[model samples]
Target: MFDYSKLITGDMPGDKIQIGDSHIKRSDTVFPILLKKVKASGKTKIVISVYGGSGVGKSEIGSLLATRFRSNGYGAYVLSGDNYPYRIPAENDRERENRFRYGGLSAIAESDGFCSDWMDIVHDAWLSGADADPELAEKYEFMRDYQEAGKTALSAFLCTPEEIDFGLVNRIIKKFKHGEKQISLKRMGRAPEELYFESVDFSSTKILIIEWTHGNNSALEGVDFPVFLYSTPEQTLEHRISRARDKGVDSPFTSIVLEIEQQKLNEQAQTASITIGKDGELIV
Candidate 1:
């Protein structure tokens, strides 16, 4: 068991982040696997990624694992994937909104037969913040296509190179694997001006672990161990609500985003080195 009182969490986790009993159990389950993987690597410095749903305890478990590594006489450090996005959280969120809204309207605009009256109704729906409601599609059949198109566009943008700076994170991994003692990591916050490079001294960091939603993304490289935390979108949303990491998490748009992200995660699960279920059990 880990000392839950003294864990070093990810760099940019939510201020309201909580470490529950389940987190401790998952870390206990994952620590030995990670240690074996690191030892088998037989390399001077190795990179690992703890990936999963947005609020599936990646930060808490990741920190606990790092603490375990240190207690076992190995050096460890945790890097956050949140800081690798191209834009700060707020700006990136607005961009996601823009992409979604554009996709919905463009689907109708590019149709062979555009309906001005239908567009008028959609305009009204947008004004009332009901454009994304499924019930709206019941009244207007065309809204179903519009909503699906919007969600598809959002899916394309989420976690892709268009949004995340996979190249930058890759370079950092390269440097770490090459035994660089000092590295400059990106730190992105919610506000526009909170972007900066943080110089981290890695002289004693033998195992560099990254805890992130897209940690197993194909775009990212040099991950010796990819540990995935599996959870349904509904479970993830419940966790997000409790964390209150950001506002508007309970919105329909946000729910759709989580669903898309979860779908992608499931698609990527086959390549994961380790998988932890929602109930803190290993998924073979």
Candidate 2:
């Protein structure tokens, strides 16, 4: 059952709220501030990104925030980050390896035969690493290192933001922002066989809510409200374990992936507008 009371508040206390053993009060402290920001933005259409490391409650909090938006008389839609992957789960591993070995975007395009000007730029930037193109090098150096690392090190490099279909995601968001009435979105079910597309009615949707670890990036540009949750790898272990069990996918590999994901996600936190602490308290 969902807790509605937790999603609403009269006034926020400076200190943490104790609810049984849970000291996290994100719903009370964070949601209210977000609501105010949405209302004050004065934009008929708004995009909110709830981003953080794995098992940090991005999906749950995003859903709650969307409900809050709807309750406040705004039409809202929640976009799943999982749907933006460049390839299906099974193929992504191969793709990541290709990217690391062959030179980022160039390698991916050559093998896949799906070339793009954007990819060309990315490829050039990566090769120009630390020379004249410091920015591009910085962006892609990790990918180069990943390619050179052993199989054991590869697990940590998998599923980073570089693997997402950023171009597709950006296009979808732009279309919606431009008042596109209808859009098709991919929804991944529990299994790969369940992947399917559903047409969404964005005709009246005033707010688009996207929650993912990599939300604070160029791919999600133009988002009106961006929320970053701060949770260390230690803090995330319990939630990750529970989620994995529920998904029937608890394993050593998943644990390693989550640890690496935490490291990458923490690096992206600096790009967020609002940062929430591990205790669910807002950090000024």
TM-score of each: 0.95, 0.67
TM-score of model 1 (CA atoms): 0.95
lDDT of 2 by residue, 149-235 (tens): 422344434544467776766787888889999988876544567667777789988988887777776555677777988887766
- The runs of at least 3 residues in candidate 1 whose Cα sits more than 4 Å from the true structure, single-residue gaps closed, are 13-16
> What local lDDT score does residue 243 receive in model 1, on the 0 to 100 scale?
81
Q: Considering every candidate listed, which one attains the maximal lDDT?
A: 1
**Candidate 1 at residue 167, lDDT?**
98
Best by TM-score: 1
Model 1 steric clash total: 0
What are the per-residue Cα lDDT tens digits for candidate 1 across 1-284?
Answer: 34567666677734344778898889888888888888887898888899999989888888888888888887889999999888888889889988988899999887777788888888898787777788887887788888999999999999999999999999999999898999999877787677788888999989888999999999999998899999999999999998887888888778888989999999999999999997778896
